[model samples]
Structure formats: structure tokens, C-alpha cells
Target: MQDLTQAAALTGPAGGEPRLVAIPRLAAGGRWRVEAMRAISEPMLLWFTKGQGRITIAGVTRGYTAHNAVFIPAGVMHGFEVGPQVFGNALFFGKDCTLPLPQAPHLLRIREVHAQQEVNVIFDMILREMNSDSPAHERATRHYMGLLGVWLERQVAKAAPEQTRPDAAKRLVARYTALIERDFRTGAGVGEFAAALGVTPTHLSRCCRQACGRSAITILQDRRIFEARRLLAETRMPVGEIGASLGFTSAAYFTRAFQHLTGKSPTEFRRSV
Candidate 1:
């Protein structure tokens, strides 16, 4: 066992690029934890060649095993607990690394599928580029990173759902997400959602729980809170104006709800960032 708090400290210095770091292997301790929010100033692509671990992003936690890869977009808060026995390579790219692919947003999760053999081979090539002592190492590394992007784009396409969620329970969850994205700022509640979806409130709640592992109200609140956070971070709107935009009649209520979900006042969060 290793001291979870100090595991990341043991890793060596970053590589030549200010925005990039080459991690040949994970920390020696099988377990590590980052107790606070960890922000990424740059995009990170982590390849877990071997090991199992758990990662929490935003408010969602998920498990990861061998051959798992994760892409953390810039500005997201995420942290991971890794098993000491893990072996992996981490690549950090600057904010301007490359244009994002059209389907990149959908590839948010670490799919429960193995990488194709060709993809694995390309990963090995990247490892070689990292270790090479040649003068052209920088060029080689950049080319390999581009290749990795192409491979990931293919994987996302292959794994994407071909059809809309067909199961009635899952469809309910999908529809809820769509509706929230469209009308979250309108302050629509679970009862309104149930009415619009043509289902009883109780039935809607049950369906949401069965498919998303969360109640309808909780999901709705989370969606609204997320939008609020985005506005706070990305826009210069006054707190009251932002709250009103989100359908809150009173800024006090919006402030309280935002604090409850994010553990910080909207003003405090905006200033801190």
C-alpha cells in the first residue's frame, strides 16, 4: 500500500513541452487519491495498459481496467484512484493541440471494449517515440499523437449507438436528458416532465431510477446546476442576471441551490476561477 495523498508527488518532472508530460508508468503504490478538485489546464489522454482503478469526473464515478483509455477535455475537474500495480502512459496536449472531432463529445466514457490490435500497435509506436533519443523526437511524437487521434475517432464511431434507446425505461431517461437540455432554464419540474412525456409522475420517477440510477428531480437539478456553472465560468453575466436567465425568480434561491450542489457560492466560484 502507498500513501494515497503523496502518490502523484513521486512522479518525475514533466517533459520538454510545458503543456505535455510523458508518464512511462503509474506511481509505485497501487492506490492513489486526489481529495480535492483537480483541474486540467490542457487536454490529457491517458492510456492504462495494465491495472484497475476508479475515476470520478464532474459527479460521476466509474471503474477502469486494463487497456482502458480516458480523455479529459480542458477545464474539466477530474481525479482518479489508481491501483499500485498499474502501468500506463499519459500524454498531455496543450490547449491548442488540434481541432476537436465532431463526435468527440460522445466519447466521454471509457467503453467496456478492448482496443483494436492496430490501435494497440499504434500506441506502442507512440511509446517508442517517447523513448527515442533521436533529434527528430519532437516531430515523431507529434505525428504519433495525431495518429492516436484518428484511432480514437474510429473507436468512437464504431461504439456509438446505432439507434435511439429502444427500451421504454432507457428511452424515458434519454427523453428526459433531451428535454432538460432544451428547457432546463425554464425551471421545469418532474411533474411537468411527466406531463410532457405523457407518463405519470410516479412512473416517470421509476423509469428514471431504473435507467439512470437517479431520480427525475435529482437529474433535473443536476442539469440546471451544470448549466449555471457553465454560465458562471464562461460568461460575464451578473449573478442575478444569470439566475434570472435560468428561470429563477429570486437570485437568493438560485444562489442557495448552486451552493448546495457545488459547495461554493456562484460569486465565490467565479472569483476563484
Candidate 2:
């Protein structure tokens, strides 16, 4: 079960108005911003028209190439690596979006030319309505969002099922990621998380490595660091408070960890951004 306190924190934009916006992949805050493991308050759709890279969602990593569409629901941990040759559009459906969306993440490899054209048309229409000064443009945008959802549904339904079921390692790692998303702010370490999941720290770490090629501790730290970066870039929260809120024992330690992972101290990161 999700902890109510943490789940509440996950809902709604903490600051500013809700936004439904679309921008090119390169404009979506660059590579590190997208390549790190993190969750956002809003759902997002990525339409990859060119290039290829790896993406991790729900603790599973997969390669993505051109004509691929990835849908990530709000509050789910996801990240992707895109190179200079990569090109695409990323559409963000705001926290307050009322349109029905898949509860899980999806990566649809669009093989049919007609299907690719259909998705392109939908994206084009969405961009058009968003940039238009036409009356009820917001409504038009909502309708287009619905169409995009429908497109995802059809593609997901048509896709072939996985050849093999999720193994024990994958299942355990998925659960571990879910718990990290739930209580990462509490500063719980790998042992505590493993205990809660009814496994020893060694076993959990082994499974995590088997599933995602990273140790359990590394995954937990990545999550915490991701939140630290978001707070530094998006808000005026004090450095000490941000670290404390993320369960860091001291400001100095937070700075060290942040610098080690991000190559910048908290203050320096804030300044650079």
C-alpha cells in the first residue's frame, strides 16, 4: 500500500498553475535532465521520430529507436538517454489532466507506416491547437490529448505479448522501485527497504543488479539525488532544508553526495541552473 503522506505529496503541482505543454525533445531540458531516474507530477508522452537510445521505466531498461512512442503516467519513475542525433517531441499532460491515461508505462514500437503517420498527425494537431489563438483552444487540446490516449490504447492492444513472464528478479526490483518512490524522502537506506520488502539487503541488491544492472543502494541514491536536483532547479527551497527533507543527515553530507552524483554542490547546482 502507498503511504498516505507520501502519496499526498505526489499529487498536484506544488507551485504555479497547471500546465499542458509540448516541446521538442532537445528543448525538454537537455540529456542529463532526461537520462536521470526521476518522477514528475504530470503524465508525459514521447514521440521519437529519429535516433535511438535506452530508456528505463518501472525499473526495466529497454532500447528505443525511431518511430517509437513511450507513454509514462504521472508519478512513475522514468528516464531516457538521447544522443545529439536523436529528435522528437515530448508532450507533457499537466497534473490536473482529466483525460483517462494508462496506469502503467508503455513503449510502443510503431512498425506500420500508416500507424506512424497517424501518430505524427495526432502530435501535429495537438501542437496546432496548443499554439492556436482559436476560441476554446484548451478544449481542443483536451480532445487531442484524448485522441493520443486512444492511439496508445490501440497500439498497446495490438502489440505482441512478451515472450517470457517477468522473472523473480524483475518482480522484486519493480517492488523495490515502487517503495523507493513511496518513501525515498524518509532517508531510508537499502537495508530498511530490503527489510520492508521481506528480503535481506544482500538478496535485494543482487536482484536489483540482475534486473537493472545497478545495485540497490545506487538506485536509492539516484532517486534521492533526482529529487534534490528538481528542488534545486524548480524552487527556492533552502539548501539545508532540501537535504533534510530528503532524509540527508547533514547539509555537508548532502552537498557531498549531490556533488558526487551530479558533479555540483547543492548551492553550485542551484546557481548554475
Candidate 3:
């Protein structure tokens, strides 16, 4: 098994443990580390201080430029594409955190210089506290996290007036993504998911493309492959068993699908990591 304690994908706390971790946006894991479809069980704050990219959250796609902060609540599916010039930090508030936070995701474009500086200072202070060896460092970091929640609220309020409610297509895709998160491991296909949601597979795919620029089947496959990579990297489980557990009918089929999406077979991918 691999030592994945430092992996960004494992941002969720274990055994109800309270955790606060901050890491560089582009860590050593892989280029597509943060650009894959997955969901975390804790609240996350992505502070993009420089560069620009496109982020898809809750099945809605939007361009994220410099000075942007995106707050994603637990259980929301999200991913983004960033180039070499992009840089930022990802902060995770553990599952046991008690701080007040947004119930829904918020994408804030900080236009004011003061507001931009304010968020940067808050992130810096939190990071410093995290790195401190003082006995009171944990308490200090928690307080700073609270301040960040407050900052997010204020920015969200300022953007609320400009916000519009999600239309039917967005709503449907959101539901579809949520369903995917819940049952991706069960081997359910996109058609099963669409049927459960009272929609046809064609309609679901159309909405997904309109909302996130990806087809429904593509999203489903991305999610399953994402989990496959995680299992391969973090566990000693046999390759065939892992594929079966993820609803793959055969190990050979799983390998082909995994390679088609990730450019590597399971054995090769595990060894590379």
C-alpha cells in the first residue's frame, strides 16, 4: 500500500477526527490531480491568487480567473483545469469542524484590491499557524478559519445581487452528479441514473454537456476511474477485486477503460505512483 497521508484527495478527516490542512495548489501528485471528478466529505476553499482556469461545480461550468475564491461545501462534485501559469492553495476544513460556512458553493471574483489583499492575508495567517510548533497553534488556526468563513460570507453577499437561480438544465445535471457520487461504485450506468431521476439518458447527456461541457457518460466514467486510481494507489487490494468492486465485469474490460481515460493500465499506473 502507498503512504497517501500527504495526498490531496484524502482531504476528508478519519474517525471523526478534526483536521485542518493547507497545500499548494499544484502538488507533486500529478498534473490532473485537481482536474478530476471527485467529491470530498469536508468543506474546501480554493484560493486562486494567480492565473486562470475553468472550474466545474455541481454540473455548472464557469471560468475562474486570478483573484478568485471558490468555496465548495461538502458532497459537491467539482474539478478544474489549470495550466503551468496557474497557482494557488487548497484549504480543507475537516468534517468535524464547527465553524459556520456557506451551505452552497460560492465563486467570488474579488475585484477590490483591499478585498483581495484581505483574503491573501487570511490565508497566509492560517498557513503560518498550521506550520507553527506552538501549543496554541491549533486554536489560532481555528480562529483564522472562522475569519475566513466570515470573509466568504461577506463576498458572497456582495455577489448575491448579481447571482441568478439555476435553471432546469443546471438543476438536472446537479441532481445527476449527486446521484453519481452516491452510486458510482455500484456499477450503475448513466442510463440507470437517468431513469432513477425520471429522465432519459439522451436528455441527461444533453444537459450535462450544456452545463459542464461534458457528456453524462463521460462524467460517470471519469468518476469511476478517479476512484480506481485512488484505490490502486492507496490499497494492497488485488487488481481484479478492485475492478469488480467498482462494477467492472472483468479485469480486462476495466484495464481497457482505465487506459482509455488515463493513458495507463492499472498495473502500470500503480507502479508509476
Candidate 4:
């Protein structure tokens, strides 16, 4: 295992007001690492402008390129592997200003050109207000945050429409999503998720793909990894204990699976971030 004394540098706003900070400022030069996964005590949004990298949450890893914004709720553990090419601002908001958000961590890919521009304006305003000497800076930032919340809600609503999916398929996948969130640490697999939903594994796969663009098994694995990353980064628990807690049969197997999806061994990753 890598040495634990050299932990990833953790940085954030140091006040009682909402704030925005450029990613490069947090990690100097062309490097970005928050590898040791840990929970954000406040609601934080990392909006990427350039570069591409993998982001794992709840065991689901996705290739996040440009124009991706990850909304992490307070208390949800997460990490990063962004580089210098990455250009964006990290918006940190107090719990009082955090808008109503989905209960789970959400990764949003903003593709619409006009919508992208709109968010950009809000980010600019936030940065300005965050660094300004005005007395209303806090209130102004909060107003901009509200706009952000609205835009994010609209984007989510636009991604999936009930009319586009068959009612039965929607219901099944919704239940499947919930089950994975609740039982992922149990080491449940695709077959089990299928069985619980009263459908065959093949049927589950088809429905999940049709409704969510990912397989049911993929969802379960992502949830497990999301929790695993948090445990590895936040605690000094022997990896074997973490693996066993997450329902991994063996430590070696856990390392392999975590590395496969996250692109780094748990030990190396925990230290790098």
C-alpha cells in the first residue's frame, strides 16, 4: 500500500459565503488530483470546461469530457483525476443556498449550445461576485446559484422524457435504480437485480438500456464503486476490511474490479488524489 502520510491536498473556500474558484488555482501547474475520495461537507459543483477524464461515483465510472458538470451533495464522498488541460470553476455553496437536488450524486453532460452559453454566463457572474469587495457579494452569489439550480433542473428534465419511454419500461428501470442504490454493497449482481424486479436478466438488460443508456449490471457496479472509493479515500481502513464491507469476496478481487472501472489501483489512487 502507498504511504498515507502524503495525503492529497484538500482546498476549498474558507468563509461563510458561496464562492467560485478556478480548478487550476486549487492544484498548481498542469496537475489535478483529489484521488482520495472524501465527502464534501458543503454542496459543491465542479463544472469542467476542457479536458477528458474518468469520474467514478457510486461505482459507476463515465468518461467526462468537456461541458460536464458534476453535482455532489453534501456528505456524498467523491474524487477526481482532472489535469491541467481542464478549465473550469468549482462552485462551493453553503447548505442554506444549496437548491433542492436529487438525493443521489448526479453527473450532467451539458450538450445544448445555447444552454451551455447560459451556464457560462452564470459562472462568470459567480466568479466576479466571489472575488468582489462589494457588501452584497454574498447575496449576489446566492442569486446566481438560484439561476444555476433552475438551469440544472431544466437540463435534467430535458434528458429523459416519459413520452419517449414505454410506461412499463420506465417503471421497471426506476425500481431497478432504487434497488441498486439500496443493495449495491451486498455484492448484488445483474441477475439479482433482475430477479428482484420480477424479470429475467435478459429482460432487465433490454429495459435498462432502453430507458437509461446503460445496462442494469453497470448501474449496480457503479454504486458499489462509488461507495468503495469513498471508503478508500476517507478512512485508513485496511483495504480488506473495506472490500469485505462492500461485499467483495476477496481483497485481490476487489482491487482488480476497482482498478478496472476507475483506471487506478485503490492504493495508488488514494495516495495520488
C-alpha lDDT values of all predictions: 0.61, 0.79, 0.82, 0.69
- lDDT by residue for model 2 over 1-273, one digit each (tens)? 234235535622242322434324433554556777777788888888898988888777889999998988877777778777788788777767777788878888899999999989988888888889999987887888889889888888787474246789888888888778878888788888888889999999998787777899988898888788878888999999999988889999999999998888999889887
Judged by lDDT, which candidate is best? 3
User: For each candidate, C-alpha RMSD in Å?
Assistant: 11.6, 2.9, 5.4, 8.5
Deviation of model 1 at 181, angstroms = 1.7
Model 1 regions more than 4 Å off: 1-64, 69-117, 120-166
lDDT of 1 by residue, 216-261 (tens): 7877776566556667866799999989877787999999988997
Query: Which has the higher TM-score value, candidate number 1 or candidate number 4?
Result: 4
Q: Mind giving the per-residue lDDT tens digits that candidate 3 earns over 169-197?
A: 99999988887776777777887888889
TM-score of 2: 0.90
lDDT for 170 in candidate 4 is 57
TM-score of each: 0.52, 0.90, 0.91, 0.56
What TM-score, to 2 decimals, does candidate 1 have?
0.52
- Model 3: C-alpha RMSD to truth? 5.4
TM-score of 3: 0.91
Which ten residues in a row are the worst by lDDT in model 1? 4-13
lDDT tens digits, residues 1-273, model 4?
222223232222222456677866755421323543334457777888999776644333457878988887665544566666878888877755556755656778888899989999999988888788999987887788889988877776776563243378756766665555445566767887687678999998887677655676766676577667666766798888889987799999999999998889989877865
Clashes of each: 3, 0, 0, 8
lDDT of 1: 0.61
For model 2, which pairs clash?
none
Candidate 4 RMSD computed on C-alpha atoms after optimal superposition onto the true structure: 8.5
